[model samples]
Target: MSSAPLSPVALFWRCCLWLILLLALPAQAQFTLGQRATDQAATPHVQARLVVQAPDGIAAGQPLTLGLLLTHQPQWHTYWKNAGDSGLPTELDWDVPPGLEAGEIAWPVPQQIRVGDLLNYGYEGQILLPVPMTVGPDFTPDADGTVRIGLHARWLVCRVECIPEDVQLQVQLPVAQSHGAFAAAFADAQARAPAVSSALTGQFEVAPDGQHVTLQVQGLPAPAQGQELAFYPEAADTFRHAAVLGRDWQQRWDGAVWHATLPLSDMRGATPAALEVVLGLPVAGSSVAEQPPAAAWRIAAPVQGQWQAAQLAEISPALAAALAANQANQTNPTTTAPPASGGSNARSGSWLMALAGGLIGGLLLNLMPCVFPVLAIKLLGFARHGSDMRAQRLGGLAYTLGTVVSFAALGALLLALRAAGEQLGWGFQLQNPMVIVALAVLFTVLGLNLAGVFEFGQMLPSGIASLHLRHPVADAFLSGVLAVAVASPCTAPFMGASLGFAVALPAAQALAIFAALGLGMALPYLLLSWAPGLLRWLPRPGPWMATFRCAMAFPMLATVVWLTWVLGQQTGVDGVAALLALLLALSALIWALTLQGRTRWLLGAVLAALLGWLLPTLAPYLRELPPQEASAASSAPGTALWQPWSPEQQTQLLAEGRPVFVDYTAAWCVTCQFNKRTTLSDPAVLQAFTLRGVQLLRADWTRQDPRITAALEQLGRSGVPVYVLLAPGKAPVVLTELIRPDDVLQALAGI
Candidate 1:
């Protein structure tokens, strides 16, 4: 009947059209379902659907189970009832028939979801929230023998960033019969819901100072007696959700009763007459493949202490205005508590002070160990251009341009990310293991190049190589960029306060401060270029230049060593070994590329394969590596002079009337290491700390620690190498980033 046999292309097009039509049919059906009981709402991070438990239609005078199912994309989660430190719980507003009633959601045990410095209670993966719906005897079926249920549901989904989504969903179910597709899900939800405990009795007493709450419970189950139990409070702003739990001093089970002392939130809004809490215990044995379920018991304990209003810390007007403006601009702002600023001595002061501080800080940054290696390269560059005054001046300007532009760009990125709710600060790049590894590899190549292992220009095409030789300005500019990259990890004396204040400033002002910092760093080199008299002091370009260039390579190599050590601190010894292997392979590849003929090609291919293998091997380490616990030696445990730091621990120690000194440092920070090896390690300083009964705490920022970040913010600092001395009933003394033994001794004496 057809006119002719279709061509292959025509036949393919016909099949594609049919496939599109088939796919479009389901989409059309779904649009109709959007107005019915089986409606589903999908978003980038989550999918929501409504289901009924009864396979048959609703029966009069019987209660039926209804469920709102939420399936999250991997690593994304929706909040629970309390929402802990920073999230909003899911909500459902139902429009039911006059005779039908809906009960509260039977919530399942929530998982502790930690995001940066905040700890949230939430659900991940798939969860079914079951609600009991009573069908009254007076209820009647619609004209079509079906009941229509309408729901307006809203939820906030979050991974690292949060997005609020809502849907108006409706479903039509048969009056007498329903599909039992979701019966098992409803049953599972019921099983996971926390039961009201009858055996356990509890009472809570607030500390007189209003800093902590102690809960005492009698009659524990045998399985949960000594096992680690999680306590989730039903009310917000009662306890510090981010405080580290499970420590013996915090929570413990004695012979007859369990006792737990939890810190009170600094922003605790009110005192409740009774504290309702869910105490959850892990299942005796659970497979990881399945959802690790918990057995939870709800307790409503009577309060036993007087209530006091939380003391609000004073903040600078600029910071307050900035925070207010930022909050006002957000359509859906996070409810995470602001960083505690009670002890902060950070003063924004006038704009002039911030600019001056940034300038002086950048100038002093040249003297830091982090910048020393790059300065050596600059020294070599200066020597090479000594004879050509015009070229030298041009090179200086190019370098300055590069430095200022790089600083501005970095500052802008930092500000933008923070605005988007990233918990980041100065030198945040070095916190990433990938950045550290990249720096290590970069320094290795630079060292090899300087040592005459290979020439960069020689590796390029003839024209590009000639251009590279002619345009030394590009090299000078890149050198400036590299200097800023390395120098950023060190927060020079005045830099901490300036950078801390800059974060709260407007984008324009913040960027200006960053540019000022770069300009100050470049000033010395710019001066040397313009002042021919200063250039004359340097030895003329000669045979010594070759030796000096080679000597500079060692400093670069030293930088590589430091970078390697920093990576080790972040990802452990295996990461260090992997990095070293990759570096060796890369060096071999570079050397092979420089060779001639088939041998070069053959060796390069082999090394490239080696690199390809080594590259993927590092991915496992890159994913959130667990922070290593500071060892006894690290905390000076032998002499009992130093211990690891935590905000709760610091508060407890201070509450106990002990002076506390905190050393906020990181492995990547050169100045921190210098201080650790020098003044901080001095015997007299240690003796003074011990003699004065001062508790020493080391807040290691080797890994990206939100708690440490928050603590630093409290002290008005944005980087490591922050020293603070605290004594009861006295203001917290904010010590400088670089401290001397005398400074420590005097601070202790004053305390």
Candidate 2:
């Protein structure tokens, strides 16, 4: 009774010693079921055990609950029945004696887990899947009056990476009247199971395009009427489980009925007569304190619309092969891991090749039309700084820093968004109408500044203008940033492979490749600034400099026009009109700022008001516009030489043994337009296609389309201007980004 209190340090050590002792004991030793029925199995991340709801013993002709309880380590989880995007559900193979039977497992409501751009439904922490077991009237026990239940259990557990584990376990119980020891555990499991709802009625309709499904459900309880709810289809391949539910797909409640429009999977293989789904909601005022509780209901709704049978059957052969290989890898884990040394060597080689390609592609980007205007401005800056050697060198370094940093930042953002489950790729920014509007305004302002319409310095405060003039390096750096913004839409040769590889690489390696691209683009300018001889070759700053600077404005104006056209393609004529009005108001505002005193204030105020009115008017057009069908704007008027590209059409064409040529292009891509007008429209090329019976298809990427993105990835590309020639039973022949008529003919000839 008089024992002294231990110090904090001593107490901590005592607890640690006890923990070590407990860890050393066998997994099954801790459980005491009084020989009713219990056995345990364990892995590095999970502990599995079998428990029955009969404490004393099983009685003849009585129904009992048997549970396979899985306790996961922190953050690791196991899948549910459907398994969502990627996973296999836990499987149990029971070895029951004669005159004994077990019913299907009663699966509990599952939680949503996101991995990169994929969504999965599973359970974390401890879960009990209860199975109803029945003892027949004729059941006989062993001489010792004990009944043995054998089970082979297999499950996949995942935190960041998945590990498949299995174990064999047997539990022995005496034949006697029994009540469950784990009454509370069994009760909790039963409470979590979804009940079949008799009150709820629903129906689903597939859109005519076969891309979306609209679901309508009525007769919701008062508590869940307007609250957020999640839909989990009981069957797979009904919709794209990986797609972000509320964002990519949409859900809303209108007091009377819950409505949801979800995108269908590209590789959908199901054409069910009715869709079985579970609607889940968070349990309010839940009594279970150990874990979060959810209430769910199961409903089977009849399908009202036709399925896209023809399109569903036309999945590309290459994509089908890839999917098959992926499934094989999941099923056979032995083939997943290669020899460590050989794996490292192969990875290193592949990484180096990607890096090199990024570098070369960046160098080639300088020759693209999109980059020309910015480079022209840099050239003028160089000519102006010809006499100052030190300033020139510093400016060059600053420009290089800006380019590299910009590329790195963009790459990081892209990776982060992807990890958060967004489907995007290179030139993804241009897909947004808002970004297009911003770029159009920027190019317009730059054009005005270069044409000597109004000086930027004059518009700013005197002190700020002085500081900017003192440091011309800032201007050079910004020029480099502008160059990247414009150049991103163009996919130069070699860039496609490198960027595609970068998306699949580790974060550090992908960023290294991005930095390499920036460095390559900056190298020539850095050399020009460093070498005095090269600087001397340029005309000295004089009247000719003014004329050259004015001429550079034409390219900038042309770029604005091109951007306007691109915006038109994405939105419509209304969007183009809004953009033009905004630009006109912005030009007038700048011109007003150059005036003096009261006149400046008056005209500037009117123009500012006009701009304010126009901006809000343009907001509606910024939303996702419905995709327009192929029009004359993309190809020559009234000419059917090129059909809109679709996976189904391509499959059908290839099946007919006809060679198919797919042109993956986008409206914002300068090189794609150039090639379209020249090489693609050439009469000789047209005649060759006609004679050889080559089917031409154009895949427009002017807006975000996941199908097109997936197809481009299959071709080892992440951006547009991807030319692919496919011959039946032959490997797809990929052409260079910039193709000549001869290149097209040669590719066709091979096919």
Candidate 3:
């Protein structure tokens, strides 16, 4: 018997399920800031106090202890010494009496707080941080001077959401000859504070190689197994919290001095003058409630001076120790570093490096998927002209020059936009729908042409072919231009670093880097031109060339299909239809250009031009369509297996004691698609996840998303596809940029 149609209730449930799957960003809004805690007469969720040790009234020309006390409301919490990804660090800015200088705050060890998927390093309940102050012998107590102190404090209070708070505190102590009750509390807080003499303190010195920064510290303690440490940079742009760490512990008479290999925060900026590194010894049965006593050390190091290949080894421990000590000595009783006035010339070196980077990057571009089709054509052209060895080589040289010149033009454009106050990046062009659509149409047309839909050689009117490639030099220049355009999507490995650096360099330097990239792209071709014998190795003119050319069309077609999907994502389904119409118009125009009769061809040209101009103009009007849902491959229930992408859903899954796996992917990335088809969607892997009760989440990166970009940045990655797995009550384990099923399983082993 046939089954009856679904009832209204069933239909409604299906629609709701679909809606929940489609709206993932609301679930991804894990980072929030607002007033989350209530302040009441019963007890405040947060409280601040300024404590100082002095006579009953306070005294001039005598030593004094300065301190701050922070208390949080029940169940709510405030930030710790090193607030993780989102919250602001607890900071205190103090103004004190003349002739009385305060020392740096002696911070106690802080607990790590977890809110959803993110981990913040801070505190939950009441905690006190103290500082010591001294009065100069020149001051007199009979003057009846009042020691006025002001503190500017900033902290973050969080419940489910986080809010940054700033407060101003004022306290006046009269110069007297006796002591107060609060002095004892200050003394007690001081004992809990980590000693300045024990923690690893140092200045970060950038290695000449630019790949590493060396930290030099004085009085560093010896390193043992399981030493937990964190580096806090005074400058926000100096060092990211996430990066591969390399630690070298040097044992000295006083303690072990740690020379950490910190990746520079921005290769475009100078290394920080000094970084406060707090290291803790793991204690038995210690939890967040019981933080291990932290060892405090300070190292003062200079960020300037050009150290070449010769200077790396000559760096002295004494110099590092002195720099650390100097930075520590100059600190105010406040823990915050003074605001930096301006950026230094560390960017100059970056530009020079960018130029070199571009050259290397360009050289690697020849092998990139985007440019491979163009390379085949160029290679075939060389083989056709092999008899004229010199000419063959000349042709290759011309192509190489073309690539370089075009890259220069692109670089200049990027630099110009930046100068105009635009926040553009390396792949910014790809973010524009118009650009993507245009490229899609162009690639589709090129694919059809290669497949023998029309012949460009026969279609051009008088002066057309000449305009396209009249002179060998012009042909070379045009080839270079086309080469760079084709190579846009396939970012060569080293080129990623080079391009990232170029984005932050000055205009001139950035352009130079691009020029270098062009040079790299054309280097091999130029070499073939300079020595024409290379073409002799290639097959002579034959039908195989035609076959190879036809085969190359497949890659171009694939590129077009990928771009079409990308266009769909950016402007939606209507935009995809518009792109298809544009492609059809392009094909008609190409045919018209090749037509024997002038009248017929003229009409095709006009129609083609009109379509090109009109379709894009109409694209913006198209409403975005929801993603097409495919039927499940297995009978597993959605609730028991795959959970649709949503930030709230993720939080819910974490709360349910389920391990969550997130895949941030894009349609444009061939690598991403391959992983989805071959690994992620594999039945074995799916079964493993199902058996383990894993909650799978997918974040589509086919479109430009600011939130995803920021998330990627937090992970120390600028691009995707990224796979992250978060187990209950632990830090998330990030898989490598490349995917491996075994690696994934290994990372999920214990969980």
Q: Write the per-residue lDDT of candidate 1 for residues 150-217, one digit (tens) a residue.
A: 88788878887665566667788887776688878988888888777578899999877678889998
Candidate 2 C-alpha lDDT tens digits along 87-124: 78999889888768888889987888878877888889
Q: After superposition, how far is residue 48 of candidate 1 from its true place, in Å?
A: 19
Off by over 4 Å in 2: 1-342, 622-626, 630-639, 655-658
Please give, for residues 196-219, the per-residue lDDT of candidate 3 as tens digits.
653434565666776556665555
TM agreement with the true structure for every prediction: 0.65, 0.58, 0.46
Cα TM-score of candidate 1: 0.65
The TM-score, computed over Cα atoms with residue i paired to residue i, of candidate 2 is: 0.58
Residue pairs in collision within model 2:
53-180, 55-179
Tell how far residue 216 is off in model 2, in angstroms: 25
lDDT of 3 at 731: 53
